[model samples]
Each structure stands twice: as C-alpha cells, then as structure tokens.
Target chain A: MAERVRVRSMMPPGHVRTPAYLRGKVGEIERSLGAFPNPEELAYRQKATARPLYRVRFTMAEVWGAEAENPDDTLDAEIFAHWLIPLDD
Target chain B: MPHDHHDHDDFHHDGMSPSGHPYRADNDTPLTYWQVMEIAIRELLIDKGIATASEIAVQIDTMDARSPADGASVVARAWTDPDFKGRLLQDASAAARELGFDIGALRLIAVENTADIHNVVVCTLCSCYPRNLLGLPPDWYKTRAYRSRVVKEPRRVLAEFGLTLPLSTRVRVHDSTADMRYIVLPARPAGTESLSEEQLAALVTRDSMIGTGLPKSPA
Candidate 1:
C-alpha cells in the first residue's frame, strides 16, 4: 500500500522549505529522494542535520478545491520529512 | 571587466520581447537588498582567501556557456538511445554527467511527456531552476505571475505560451520547493525518425524542455 501523508500546517516564521500552498494538504508519497541537509536550518547558517525528503503528489482538486481548472491534474513538490505527518488512515 | 561597467549589454529586441513581455532594464537597475548582500558575501569570501576575483569571473563564464543546446542534445540522445534514456530516467544528473556535462550537485528529475500526460516545472517560493543543465531561465520564468499562476492553473498558463493539450491529457506540475530541480523530456516529434541526432536536437526548444511548449515540427 502506498503511504499517505499530510503536510504540517504550522505557521512558524523564519526560513521554511515547505510552501504555503502545500501546508495542511494531504498527498501520497511519490518517491523518497534520500537524505539531504535540512534547508530550513541551512538557511540560518546553522549546523543543519540531514533529513529524508520525499516527492509528494497531490491532486489539483485537493489543493484548489472546486476552483481547480482540472481536478484530476496533479502537482508534485519535494517536502522534507519533518514537514510531513504520517496519516493513520 | 571594468569595476564600474554595468552588466547590461547586447541583445536588443524591438518593443516586445520574444516572451510577449517588454524587455526590462534590470541589469542597470539599482541593486536590491539581496544583491547588496550577495556582493558583501562575495567580497568577504574573496577577502578571506576562500575564492578569487578571477575564479568568480571563470565561474560566471562557465554558467553562461551552459545553454539549451546541451539539454537539447541530451533529449536528442534519449530519443534515439534506449539505454541512455533508461539511465536518464533513472538518474538524470548521472546521465547528464555521462554525456560529459558538468552539472554539479543539481539533483534533476527528468519527467517524460507521454501521449496522455504533460509535465511542467515551476518554483513557487522562488525561481529554482535546472540552471546548470539549461542555462539561466527566461525572465518570465522568474516572475511572480508565472511562479504563482503555474501551480494554480497550469493549463491556462501553458495556453498563454500557445500550447493546448487534448481533453484527455493530464498535466503534472512540479514545484521546485527545495534541493531538487526538474526538466521535462519532451516527447520526440513524429516524422523525425529520418532526421539525424543533431537535426533532432534543433527541434528541442527551451520552452519544450521547460514543458511550456512542444518540440518544433520538422522544418
């Protein structure tokens, strides 16, 4: 079974790799991109820890509700593991 | 290479630029805060003996030398060689390096444009692009309108570029939110089976690789 995840909707300020549009949206894991330096910490000149990243795919409808030009079309974005919350369902 | 010499030079179009937007005098414009910060950091790096002035010039030259031709050649080869295509799909950066392209640290994902699926690349936060592979992005690609509209209405945004997909065709938009960059491996145009590898490359336009348009028909 494919793993489903939801982007954390936290509103903390400062350098964030997670886009505002993708926050709180549910998507499926498209693929794991291996571990990379956490950009959020790297932006602040801090000793960044490596974090696993995944390409998450969300349907247009899931992102834009009924306003989606084509509900079936999809959007993919690289999200750090920390920004994603594993959904029990 | 004079110290006071402004960076703007050459390439004058009439009123409207090729992308249907007016050309901006951005090179001669006053430096923004970020630009000033960049100069400060670079000067500090140079002063600290971490890098040299000539090294920066050479780096700029190297980046300027990378053009769509390099990517077009990759696409052309992929269209012809199944083995290379497989490698390209598997690991785009490695595949590009295999072709003698020095794409340093660019984690690229090459999405294929099948008959029923179309792929587009954008950066919502900023203009993160596959610069090492395709050279500098067009001015439009860096604009707020493009960055915002692309992820929202990709089809409509593509239509402005004069590309219209069939009703059955699905569009996939890739937003470069982090380290990874993306490039579309545009499907080869039909009737090019007889064309040479070089000839096939000529059809791969910048927009085609960016997924805003399709490869040009044989001319």
Candidate 2:
C-alpha cells in the first residue's frame, strides 16, 4: 500500500512555502525527492536546514469535496517533509 | 531597436533592465521604488566587488536568450525518440541539460498528456513557472484570477482557453507550490509522423506546453 500523509495545518504568518490550500489536506506520496534546504528559514536569512521533499497527489474530490470540478481528476504539489505528517494506513 | 538610452545627467544609466525600456525618469515621473532599489542593490554589489557590471549584462542576455523554442526542441525530440522521452519523464532538468539549456538549480518535472489523462501546470501560491526551460511566464499567469481559479475550476478555465476535454480524460493539475516546477509534454498532433523534428518543434506552441492549448495540427 502507498504511504499516506497529511499536510500539517500550521499557519504561521511569515515566509511560509507551503500553500494554505494544501494545509490540512490528506494526500498520498507520489515520490520522495531527496533532502533540500528549507525555504522558510532561507527566506528569513536564517541558516537553512536540509529537509526531505515529497510530491503528493490528491484527488479533486479530496480537495474540493462537493465543489470538485471532477471527482476523478487529481492535483499534485511538492511539499517539504516538515509540512507532512505521516498517516498510518 | 533600443530606443531606450537613459540620460546619465539624471542618474547612472547602465541600462541594466532587460525590458529595454528607457530608465529616463524625470521628477515628474520619478523612478519606481523597485527601480531605485534594484539600482541601489546593483550598484552596491558592483562597488563591493561581488559582481562585475558586464557579468550582470551577460547574465541578463543569457536569460533573455531562453524561450519556448528551447522547450519545443526538447518536446520534438521526445516525440521522435522514445528513450529520450523516457528520460525526460523520469528527470526533466537533466533531459533539458542534455539539450544544452543551463537550467541552474531548477527542479523540473515533465508531465505527459495521454489519451487517458491531460495535465496542466499552475502555481496557486505564486507564478512558480519553469522559466529556466520556457522563458518568463505569460503575464496572465501571474494574475490572481488565474492563480485562484485554475486549481478549483480547471475544466471551466481550460474551456475559456478553447480546450474542452472529454470527461473520460481525467484532468491533472500540478501546482508548483514549492521547490519544483512543471511542464506539460503535450501529445503530438496526428498527421505529423512525416514531419521532421525541427518542423514538429515549430508546431509546439508555448500555450501547449502550459496546457492551455494544444499543439498545432497539420494544415
């Protein structure tokens, strides 16, 4: 089974790279990209700690519910590992 | 064609702006805050020996040289060569570099369009485009309407661009929210089997790579 993860819904007002729309959304990991420097800290001129990145795939139905353009359609986005909370299947 | 020489009497006129617009601003039309900031930062950088004036000019020239044609050639090769296409799908940045485009730190992903699925690229967070491969993004791509509406109502938005996909074809939208950029590898138009790679490249329009339109069909 594919690993499940949820985007952490933390909304701090600063140089956040995670999109607010994807926050709180549950998605499946499409692929795990190797570690990269943190953009949030780098945006603040702070030392950027390397973190793993993952591309997550979410269905339109999962994102928009009844308002989904097409329930069968999908969306993908790259998220930092820090923003993702592993979900047990 | 550069009707854009600035008056050195008013301010230093290195003509660093790639837009080719004259930086000749009078008190009546003072330079914008960003223009002044860019000038200040660029001057400071040059003064501090961190970068040379000509190096900046050459960098701008390099950026200006990139266009959809670079991506078109890649697509044309992919259409003609299955092995290259496989490599492109697996690792886009390397594949683009194979064609001599110095994408420089751009993490690119090429999504293919097939009979079962269609892919579109957007950046709901901002205009996170594959500028390294496709040049600067279209102006409308940065508009709030496009960034907001496309993710939620892609079919409707794509229809506005005159693309009406069948329901059987699942629409997949990639939002380049962070760390990565996307390009749509559009399906080659039919009746183009006899066309040369260069000719095929000519048919791959910029909009097709963005997924707003399809590649030009043979006339």
List where candidate 1 sits over 4 angstroms from the true fold: B1-31
lDDT of 1 by residue, A17-65 (tens): 8999999999999999999999888999999999999999999999999
Candidate 1 per-residue C-alpha lDDT over B1-219 given as tens digits, one digit per residue, 9 for 90 to 100:
653343322223355554567776668778999999999999999999999999999999999999999999999999999999999999999999999999999999999999999999999999999999999999999999999999999999999999988769999999999989999999999899899999999999999999999999998
Error of 2 at B13 (Å): 36
Per-candidate TM-scores read 0.90, 0.89
- Pairs in clash, predicted candidate 2: none
Model 2, A1-89: lDDT tens digits are 24899999999888887888888999999998888889888888999999999999999898899999899899898899889899885
Best by TM-score: 1
State the number of backbone clashes in model 2: 0
lDDT of 2: 0.90
Highest DockQ among the candidates is held by which one?
1
Q: Least lDDT summed over 10 consecutive residues: which range in candidate 2 chain A? A: A1-10
List the lowest-lDDT window of 10 residues for candidate 1 chain B. B4-13
